[model samples]
Target: MAKLTKTFIDKVEPPAEGYAIHWDDKLPGYGLRVTANGVRSFVAQGRVSGKAIITTIGRYGLFTEEAARKKAQKILQDMREGIDPRAVNKADAAMKVTLQDVLEAYVGRPGKLKASTAAEYRRQVEKTFAKWAPLPIASITRDMVKERHAALVKGGLEGKKAAPASANAAFVTLRILIRFAMDEYRQADGTPLIRDNPVDALKHHWAKLGTRTERYIDRRKIGEVWNKLHAMRGEVQGYEALASVDLTIFGLLTGARRDEMATLTWDRVHMDDHDPAECWWHITDRKRGEDLQMPLSSQAVALLRSRPRLKLADGTESPFVFPSWGKSGRIQDARAPMQAIGEIAGRHLSLHDLRRTFTNIAMRECLIEKFRTDLLTGHKPASDDVTSRSYLNLTRLNEWLTGEVQKIGDWIEQQAAIAASKNVVPLQRSA
Candidate 1:
């Protein structure tokens, strides 16, 4: 075999199928490998513990012939000593790996992260940690983390101070990433690449950020907000616009999340069940990663009944309750209409605020028990008592929940009527 050279490697032809290897006569166990797919790589072939082994050095254009020979010589020497150079190279690569590399692996692993979670992680990494993407994972120090954390809170990089909540979120994301890397990556000696997570420093000494209070309409103002939302139906023109009004109201009535209401499908809405007790909305997938069957309130059922069924050109009805021509194929956001409704209410509101309003009204006005309120809102039970839960029948529990929710709905209607009367003035003012 001719000694592998740049000129020889350039002229070598790949086999029609499979792969071909040309060994160098001058350098034992050093060779060039060519594949049918037009790949040309330098390789080292040797025996370790009496078993034949072949290890790729690198591609031709990337590694010069002399460099490849030198690498091959080292690899062959290692093999003779019963040490695998590939393992050593892998350990070295692990030490030199970047945060971006670990993130891709962490998110790409099967069942490790949900699509929404993966998307959020990608956003934070790309937007917040762009500068740190290329830094070696092993080289990340506690001081570096503290500096980044301080920089994020001070808004030094972005030119304006960020919200403490936003800064906290970035720090939390980094903590999770570094923790994941520590668990997954290892050094040549099989020890964890990260000894102690630098994020621990922040957790220990940094002044903890307080949780932001959830914004919800006050109990006394629920009537005014409900009446304003009902009036908005007339001001809005299209079916989708009207649907947004209904969706906002439904959010208040049922305490469902924005996506849950927006993405509700017909099949999940069991409106015509023979048993009123059995009538419920089945959320097949929820954020907490479980199926939730929430019994519909009387007002909720009426709202769903009023929605228009959209049909395609083929005469097939659309699956989504709040169908839209938008890219998501459903009513994704109702920010504009919600903003208008909030203005009328005299307080800024969000879709989530509606859910909070439901909970507040149920607890304070309706006098519903906390456990039942939690159940109605699709929150996990605080009491983990197996005996209490076992004795409870789901149908009976739903029946009780439906009654409680109906009380809130009825109260809101009464308030709406009172609010309407205030809008009316006696005609005797002309006298």
Candidate 2:
């Protein structure tokens, strides 16, 4: 490239076809180019601070000489300030999106969410997403992510409001959302927009301290929680409706993750699809990662049918077994109904506790055995035999797992009756 002094830019002219300068041209950041294509592009003379830093300005007539000089001078100024021009360009390139925008796109994406599960994301978004929303995409550096993550660990959402586990949930949400952007978007040069996500830098922190979402609540007090849920009353249903009944019962019976049960569609549930000797729920991908096919008991089916034809805004039957609170034919906040039940029970118990309760109850029931029980709970198998159990040509395994879940359901229902005996008087049926 020719010397890019003020005189050079003022008096220098382009060649008939291709322009070149003797000082230096081909090396990046060394020279400017005004190709026959009429594009006036900048080519920096050298790397910035030993890091390659080559960036383009604009087209020839499209970007005036005066405008190009200003941008060039700014780049030089940044270099003088010990701010690598390459880094500044890289940083500027990454700021095309914001943290808030990425998260909203993720949670609001149309698929696989039970109304209740989606609502939980909404709650998380409302609380944490807002705090980081304004941050530029590039500004969401490893340091920023680490600072927030450390705060979550040291105290959780401010000194001690959310648990470490809850804080981790927030982190996971951020990681997945940011990752989505990196995998999806690209730069003007067609390079990947984000080559690396800062979230990956924090994986060690997360791995050493297991995810915040999976803390196992103890079992001894779960019975108390069960009793409370059985005794609680909903507003309109008072202490009596089946909708309220199914909410508490299903959680305890299947040991399926809470949202997994909430998003159940009758079509996915085929209780009558099998012979009496072989009933099934035919559960689908309730958890995001794997394909789960949970067989249902007659009791599971009964609990499911207990709230058939969910409330719809148009007053017609809604497709969802559990409609969205907003009447979008999706489930409303699943945690809300379960939480209400807990509040009524006077325990403030979480729905996840119901899963723990299911595990405990299953442990007590030898009818289902160990690995089979874990299968129904969606926990990974303890052995190869257990892993292969679901794949067996079950003239019996299908019926067997369904029977196991049903047996556990029966045990839970019986205990629920006992718990409610002292609380809610109207026991139309057991949990």
Best by TM-score: 1
The candidate 2 region of ten consecutive residues with least summed lDDT is 207-216
Root-mean-square deviation of candidate 1:
6.6
lDDT of 2: 0.58
Tell me the deviation in Å of residue 234 in model 2.
5.6
Tens-digit lDDT string for candidate 1 (234-307)? 78887678778888888988888877788789998877546666667876555563577788877888888888
Write model 2 residue lDDT over 76-134, tens digit each, in one string: 66655556665556545556677766656666778756556666766666666566776
Q: How does candidate 1 score on lDDT?
A: 0.78
lDDT of 2 at 216: 31
Name the top lDDT candidate.
1
Q: State candidate 2's TM-score.
A: 0.60
C-alpha displacement of 68 in model 1, angstroms? 2.5
